[model samples]
Target: MPIEQGGRVSWGVDHLPYGVFSRPGQAPRVGVRYGDRVLDLAAALHDEVFAAPSLNPFMVRGRAAWQATRALLREKLTNDMAVTEAHLVPLEQVRLHLPFEVADYVDFYCSLDHASNIGRIFRPDAEPLLPNWRHLPVGYHGRSGTVVVSGTPITRPHGQLKAGVFGPCVKLDIEAELGFVVGTPSEMGAPAGAFEDHVFGVTLLNDWSARDIQAWEYVPLGPFLGKSFATSISPWITPLDALPRIPGPPQDPEPLDHLRRRADWGLDIVVEVAINGEVVSRPPYASMYWTPDQMLAHMTSNGASLRVGDLFASGTISGPRREERGSLIELTWNGNDPIKLADGQTRTFLEDGDTVTLRATAGSITLGEVSGTIR
Candidate 1:
């Protein structure tokens, strides 16, 4: 697509997000979003930089390559004679695929609001923040195999539940998250500052959850079948360099040097949750208590090596208000309160035919959206 008269697209030249795409009867290829158009990267770059079905190869090429690629695209879009129009395709005409392969997935419970509210529900008489909660980025390894692209329908998962119950999960829910993708692998014992060199981009993630199964199974260990069924991600990944960080929340009992981040790692993105066609919540990404960089530092503090395409997600991002809660469990107070939908439908938990969409916007550009229908 021509870089428009005003030299800005909805995604804009500043945000040349990348994704894999294909049209009817065509092989999947790499494409970069420029405004409302998708530029076939293979054709525009005049090479096979993005020939593979996934973006792993391109992503793992390191920061220099990523910067060079973005620079080239920005220059081309800025100059009128830099490229031809034939290489661009209307975004609505093509299918966007998973931008990169996921090697490992970790979900962190770092949101003070989300955790505090949940703590009250599970342990009303106890302190909201558990011991050691503020000192570390508490998280768990998730099933990477079940991660899927946007638009993929998720079947409600069945698992052992509370009160000896076992069946399709009745309390199916969604967690709005900002997922960080690793581009450069880090050696064991890399500090949190390695974030500047290793982390690649960001994607909107929907961590599908089964609250009933989780409540029952979480006695000894954390999430398993309740969360492993599926995790959906947006098709495009906005490179880290493209986003300007905003100030993050201050940590009490300051973190150690390994978890320290001098720069503001928080994002000032507007997050919203839509059910069917109506927006139910507006969760702010800036409200997150733990930054992705801190999570990375903690994940590797144990000498765990990082790999390309590894995904680390900010667990359910809930804010201080009732409407901003990311899941029905908190919004409905564990199903005790029913929320009204746009169509005048009332629901405590997701019912069959319910569609939940998680979306975010950074300034005027969309960070991309992920949605899944309960089938």
Candidate 2:
């Protein structure tokens, strides 16, 4: 298959896509995400294990494996004879694993609206943004061990909740976010630009939070127990290249010297969250103040080392428009007013047995969705 001669066409599927595949009875092996289906690398090459020629050096290795896989699939798919009759599995039948194995996790607070909303709740007289808000992307190290696949069930995290000064606490909330999956590694102490070519895909993520715990311990440092209870990601990874290009320049204050990219960067993805079975908030990925490229470029500037599966989450995506808020907390104004669902139930936060699914569509030909039930 000759992919190089495919020309300078702008194809989203070609840019950033990966998946996991295997034959019936065999455990799923990694594959690349394609339109309406997956390109089974393991079966296409007919290898018992994941190793194959021109592919052996990259398979299951790291982002390099994904980079290699992308190159090969483009060749094979372009010619249309790489792997025949491999049983095109119904996309719904397959269980999704976290597209890449994450080595570390980082959650960033780059949304000014989220920052301002949370801040106004406490210090009404002071400004919402921190003094360092415009300097760089603010982030917190997260627990990688708790990162689960798309369909996994999430147990309500148990934590202390203090209601008032020396009062018993009780409240929990979930922060909806868009996650970034790396395709290449960056050496520590370098800059964010190093990750531009290293990034492979993006997915919807939910960063669960305990508002009660957060209100108490958040004085010097940011979230700890209030933040790290449980986190979820959609099963499929939408390649960055598959996303539609944004039309305008980056949000103002621009970015630090290290976090600059072309104006058209960032994928145009429509993101939404459904509670129980009703749709709540639908925020477009374009609403983000900072694009992933700026985020990556800023992250690496400190010379931080990243692994093949290191996940970077954009803190709750909120827009200037009221309906564009990504989380219920922001939408309801901290439960000042309750949102009425189609079923006549009210929700300030997700409840037991409540299921939340996050999904995004790049176009009719490409998309990814993930849902999980609360236990």
lDDT (C-alpha, whole model) for all candidates: 0.87, 0.66
Which digits, one per residue and each the tens of the lDDT, describe model 1 over residues 112-136? Answer: 9999999998899999889988999
lDDT (tens digit, per residue) of candidate 2 on 49-152:
44222222232355555556566666666665535336345555665465556778889986777777777766789987778776677887888888877778
Q: What is the lDDT of residue 277 in candidate 1?
A: 68
> Model 1: how large is the Cα RMSD against the reference?
2.2
Q: What is the lDDT of residue 150 in candidate 2?
A: 76
Model 2 residue 225 CA deviation (Å) reads 1.7
lDDT of 1 at 44: 82
TM-score for each candidate, following the candidate numbering? 0.95, 0.83
